[model samples]
Target chain A: MRAGAAGLAVWPRWRPVHDNGELKSGETTMAYSEKVVDHYNNPRNVGTLDKNSAEVGTGLVGAPECGDVMRLQIRVNAETQVIEEAKFKTFGCGSAIASSSLATEWIQGRTIDDALSIKNTDIVKELSLPPVKIHCSVLAEDAIRAAIGDWRKKNGAE
Target chain B: MAKRVESAVAAACPGCAAAQEGRALFCAQCGRIQPPPGCDYFTVFGLRPHLNLDAAALEREFHGLSRRLHPDRFIRAGAQEKEWSLADTALVNDAYRTLKDPLRRTEYVLKLSGTWGGPGKEKTPADLLEEVFELNMEVDEARAAKQAGKDERAQRTGLEAARARVAEMVEGLDRELRAQWPAWDAGAEDTRRSAERAMALLVERRRYLSNLVREVDEILGE
Candidate 1:
């Protein structure tokens, strides 16, 4: 309700002011990787999937530390159990956006079980996420597992 | 100079070598400023570590200390006394700022007691995760409508409604936080720890929801 509270990061418009930019005095700045910048600028599969559909599984997760929320959905082939489409909407810093964008790209066309193998470390390595931003990659990995879990629960596959 | 003043304990006053019992910023005997005490803010005010306090009394005490410790009053004093005055004033100012506000005072108590780890140290509870995610979805929809430049009134109405709901939620959380004060202030160790955990979560949840409401207000006002 206070004036400055609105400035906290939420989604879309208020990008991380200094995620890949300036640093406050006495703090060191780390440049985002070129790949992270690219994915953030043109994020892939940024939207929602049909939550009501039997074949669609939605995963919603958040990191309270930075107040980042990510929702990822996957549409699976009923017979093949392969993820045919993946979409994501991430409200976070550049590292988070890049991680989720890359997640959608990696999970699509892979079977749900295979997608489950994707690790936060892989995203971290791919995006060159600094130590401080590693949690964003972990969040992306959690979203993948949550989506798969949701699909399994809906399918009674357990 | 101020850093050194903060780090050392002024056990004895440099001006008159009077014995100081606790970490007090001014010598009782000599009435001269001492080093900024190596103590918590509550100690600076000579109060017990507690959440509830008399705000009026605190303000009066702060003003009285500020006036006495003002550097201008120390201009003709010894150089060391002058430096001590500046350092002690800054310390009192920091202490007062942290203690005057309810939320900040709660956070400072938890931090001093080592019961609450800062953000990123603990796993966010699942319920808060769901609430925050859903709130973001609504915020995103409002933001999208505003960006698209379509159905302006509908967007404004939706945002206003959402803002009202979030404000109500924040009020609820504030009450919940306040309810834990008794356990924190007087209970046994187990009860205090549980109260600490609950209070910490409540604080974080309140912060997130209030931030969402602020964002909605900004969109509506724009």
Candidate 2:
């Protein structure tokens, strides 16, 4: 009985918790950020934009020399400054895909200023990305800012 | 197998009455020599005979062709046809790999246009010769210093400094190429000779930078 009691004491008291109405697992897992991995495995907004649209902002960044090419587009309402839609097509590795996806998700329904304010570091933190993949998020964030800047320039808004 | 033979004969020698059987070198009726299988890289890819090209467009075209002509898609073909397919695919991959990188592309273009020979085999540009000579001398001095077991720190520092200089030169040449690209694309026929001259300079610059980078990489073991 004493040996069994000692064994029980040594064993970690594993208990699932309710944190902010969501269940939290006690065990450590090596699984990647589910949202980022999902987007990487199955990418969204993978296509070109309609250049004819006046309300669209198109930003093409990255070089093949760098082994990455990304194109980001945002459709915004002229007066409201709200992002109606966001899309991206990237030719890069899994990190790039996840970055693009995260950027798309962050920008939808947000104002141009809000979208531009979203930093690469924030994306990195949210996705729990490693150091090597931080640049992918930076590129995505740069694309978002570039697209917004283009939109504002087109509309003659400072 | 028989079907493939018929198709190959028809494809290679259209409208020939006498279709030679089983890899014959000559036509039975006309006695004319048959051309070799597989087209040249330029002909097959439909690219102009130039060193400079749009890399993005080349990649897109390569992927499109690969989807259709890859050997994996020709598994049902007989031995000879499969062999041709594999060889052709390999050639395509090689061409794309060589053409994608700017320095290799320049060297290949020079060779194709009958201007430059192999590595360290061409005349150095007059303006660059002195600097190139100086850099080579510096590299040799550093190597000698390391061999003598004296001033190892200084030798290593000199090597790193030389590598940095080469990296800066590479960046400058890359910038020049980027600046010249749009103008080259939009230039008038009368300005084409000047554009070609500018392109030749860029190509030479790329060659110099590539050699420098290779030397640095070898020393650094990178």
Candidate 3:
């Protein structure tokens, strides 16, 4: 019953990844994009900002059916309009959390105008989000826009 | 009664000197300790692999085997017998746990046969796609109402209604799943494919129910 080398090909085809970001044998959730897991587990600058400060801009967004909420805040320098810091809090799935976390990281060190240009597609590309979790990326994009809008209103820029 | 799936396989009973079928726990001639590894849970308990099972008999067999496999009895046995008892006891416990619950048993049977590996990815239902957009908007409105200190009674009611609707949908999926169980038990070649379809449906149902529970929790402040 010894077979040729072609018989071994079936076993190799199923192993997509090994050890690195590999899911356990019987995980129910989709195979998470590696970057998503990175951002989710080690989210950057996760905290609250002084909402009353003229320098801080806050955006809160939630999806009804998904019941997930994301809060993103950015601190912009008054004169330069450059982002000094960014932080976010997400109460959702791993994808949602990673989306907001990556958003906060991307907003930091960029000018307000530059940050505004950031899109959900960039997040999707960076995170390798599947179709089901695309909304999480969209939520991140919306948060960035909302936060920038709030900042502009407070600073009389818009 | 359990029928051995692999007729060519045979084993010597450990407890009493007798030949037993593959994956059978007790010898037909002498009822003694014999557990075959990787045996299906139903077979472990001397029952046919079927969807509609006798609950009382399952419980009785489970208790009896658990007592037989107790570590206390292996105190004087040799190293091999002791190892066998320990391994078999753990397997017996695991088998009992899976077979006791209908949902777990269904999933276990499917997974054991290697017919369905896991839930398929990226197959969003068209109906869910349409509903998700509106539901997200409603969530946004509810949040805004709460923020503005507006009367939120209506929003809460709507959320409760959504939860009830989801529960009803889950119940429907459960009925659909149960209806297919008889086909699986019939063991026709065509029924195998039907069982695979039913298992896939169960996976989708679980996903939808999980989302509904999350939504209800957020709305109800749970």
Model 3, TM vs. native:
0.54
Rate residue B45 of model 3 by lDDT.
88
Cα lDDT of all candidates, in order?
0.76, 0.59, 0.67
How does chain B of model 2 score on TM-score? Answer: 0.65
Please give, for residues B1-222, the per-residue lDDT of candidate 1 as tens digits: 012234357668787999876568778888877778888787787777778777877888798888898767887998777777777887888778778877778766766666554444566677887777788788777877676787888888888888888899999988888899889889999998999888878877775686677667767776
Candidate 3 backbone collisions, by pair: none
TM-score of each: 0.72, 0.43, 0.54
The true-versus-predicted C-alpha distance at residue A110 of model 2, in Å, is 85
Runs in model 3 deviating more than 4 A are A1-92, A95-158, B1-22, B26-36, B115-152, B218-221
Measured by lDDT, the strongest candidate is 1
Residue-wise lDDT of candidate 2 within B25-117, one digit each (tens)?
334576433332333344445666444586677888688767766657667866665665555565567667666766555545444544444
Q: Give DockQ per model, in order.
A: 0.20, 0.01, 0.04
For residue A130, give model 1's deviation from the true position in Å.
9.0
Score chain B of each candidate by TM-score: 0.90, 0.65, 0.73
| Number of the top DockQ candidate | 1
State which candidate, 1 or 3, has the greater DockQ.
1
